[model samples]
Target chain A: MATVTILGKELAVDADGNLANLSDWNEDIAREMAAQDGIPNLTSQHWAILNYMRKVFEKEGSAPSIRRLTKESGVDTKTLYQLFPKGPAKRAAKIAGLPKPVGCI
Target chain B: MPSETEFQPIQKVSIVISKGSLDGVYPGLIMANGARMEGIEASLFFTFFGLDAILKKRMDNLKVATVGNPGMHMPTLLGALPGMSAFATKMMKKEIEKIDIPPVGEFLTMIHDSGAELYACRATVDMYHLKREDFTPELDGIISVGQFYEKAAGGQIIFT
Candidate 1:
């Protein structure tokens, strides 16, 4: 376990840096996490991905995979790489305040 | 010269599998999927009996290996009964599907779309008389073990 401070409040994070508690998530926290992940600014594209992941996680209890991101999340693979730089699935999920995706490398 | 801190990170993982049953194939798929999930390049090499899982016609029909298995709770005699393999496969499939995970076919599509490279063993293809058309459309290509080795060179290789 690890901890990341967001807006002066510390929250638990997983070994891979994903939020351990979904309750600790919010848009501002998302922005802070995204910045920590190397994206100092969050664009609409990043929000779109974050929103989609959080929405799916709310119902499914897990974030969607990169495959689902490209297929159903209205984002394409090339653009996803451009947005997240590297390891889009892990990075995006982390920024969205979700746990590392199940079975992720 | 590359900076000490800028040396290349591990970029790829090669998984070699020689078992073809449902149980055998899913671990390889999960590992490859897991690798891609972490932004690593993942390649699955199917050889020998493992070729059964990637065969277009048989990929979706893979059955569990229940015979002489110690891990499964059932007695070895019960493992030989008709429908046991299918029953076990169905049970496993249903369990994984509840979490929104796709079936074997769709799982392949997801991993492929996520950038995991799929490959078939050339010798296995030839030995089985399987045509290139017999594998899923996502297969990068069939290659010999030597070629696979060349591609997998330094990162990591796991035999499943």
Candidate 2:
């Protein structure tokens, strides 16, 4: 397990699943998270999304389908899509502190 | 690094809609709409004054602020003077409608129709004396700040 500090809080991230250097991503996510006070904690749901984003990046080197993610995560397809303006994989990946996937631009 | 070779799929996004003004509301709506188009699970937690846009009666009245809002640029400024605010709002409404994007009411309706979760802050609801009926019928429910945070974990969180 690797620890990353975000918004003055430290979070434990799975080393095996983490993308790139853990510290770098942690700082970036911390800054992003700190921008808003409305969202306070990191939950399993958030992690599941992040993990999925990383997996998609690794496989296709790009974001995956909302249809596939909805089926996979069992979340509503529309709700899933709304979470990432740039697409689920891209937005979630950025928030998860993972690197930008290929073909995202 | 070899570690970078692995890929991940993003599953969710958490957004906070804080400004109720027309300009303020657009970013949140646009982002939320964009997210839906991409198939990501997204939620918007409306707090403080931001609740105005979701309120049944006030939604259509959302206006762009000309004087103090730093985010308002040239086109928006030109649109806010004299009768321009109304004209600008009308034009914006027309453009969105042309693209089949719903008005704030319908846009939000589509969001709910698409299964996007909407939360009105409990504190704000009480502060404003807003009954459940005051908001759009599609609201998923009201949540405390803590509850909102609990839901925001792990995914990307945005504030607009």
Candidate 3:
């Protein structure tokens, strides 16, 4: 496990840097996490997908995979890549303070 | 002592599907899909019998390998029986569905929609006299072996 500091509060993240406990998630934490990932600013599109992911995770107990995210998040694959960079599901889930999604590679 | 970490980044991956059977197509699909999900460019080349994989009607109707398959766990004699392969395919499909994994057709759509390029072998296309109409609209086009190499250049090329 690794740790990320958000709002001066330290929280443990999984090996992939996704938050291990969803309760530690909030907009402030998400902003910090996004900054850590090289994005100093979060666009409305990023927040849309992140909030959708967080909502689904809070209800389902797991972050959505890229497949589910692309299908239902109203974000196309190319746009998701543009916003999330290296990997959408992993990065978005991390910023949303959700655990790593198990379904993706 | 060498460090335990190496940061090798994959810019692209070309996955070749040589077999059309259900077992054969999935590996290439999974790898390419994985690469695309990782934000790496992915390309798929289907050759020989594997061209059946992209055929609009047969792509989703592939059969599990039963005949002479060591992993199938059945006697060779039983493996020769009709419907055995279909039965195994059914069982595999059910399990895959239970895991929320998309079926073959839907998976292909997902990967294609995700920006992964799909190609078919020109030799196979010529031999079969196959037209573009024979395949799914997602088919990028039929390319020669040399063209495949060109496309695979500067990327990890995997033969499956």
Q: Evaluated with TM-score, which candidate comes out highest?
A: 3
CA shift of A11, model 2, Å: 46
- Highest-lDDT candidate: 3
Candidate 2, residues B10-78: lDDT per residue as tens digits?
667888999987778877876775665556778989998789979999988887666565554656556
Cα deviation in Å at residue B55, candidate 1? 1.5
lDDT of 1 at B89: 85
Report the C-alpha displacement of residue B141, candidate 3, in angstroms: 2.0
lDDT of 2 at A63: 56
lDDT by residue for model 1 (A1-105), tens:
688778999899887777899899989998887877789999888888989989999998877766667778788766787788668877888888888777442
lDDT values for all models? 0.81, 0.67, 0.85
Error of 3 at A79 (Å): 4.2
- Per-residue C-alpha lDDT of model 3 across residues A13-46, encoded as one tens digit per residue: 8877678887878898889889988989999989
Q: Please tell me what DockQ candidate 3 reaches.
A: 0.53
State the lDDT of candidate 3 residue by residue for B21-77, as single tens digits: 888888898888888777799999999888878998898899998988899989988
Q: Rank the candidate models, highest DockQ first.
A: 3, 1, 2
Off by over 4 Å in 3: A6-11, A35-45, A76-79, B1-4
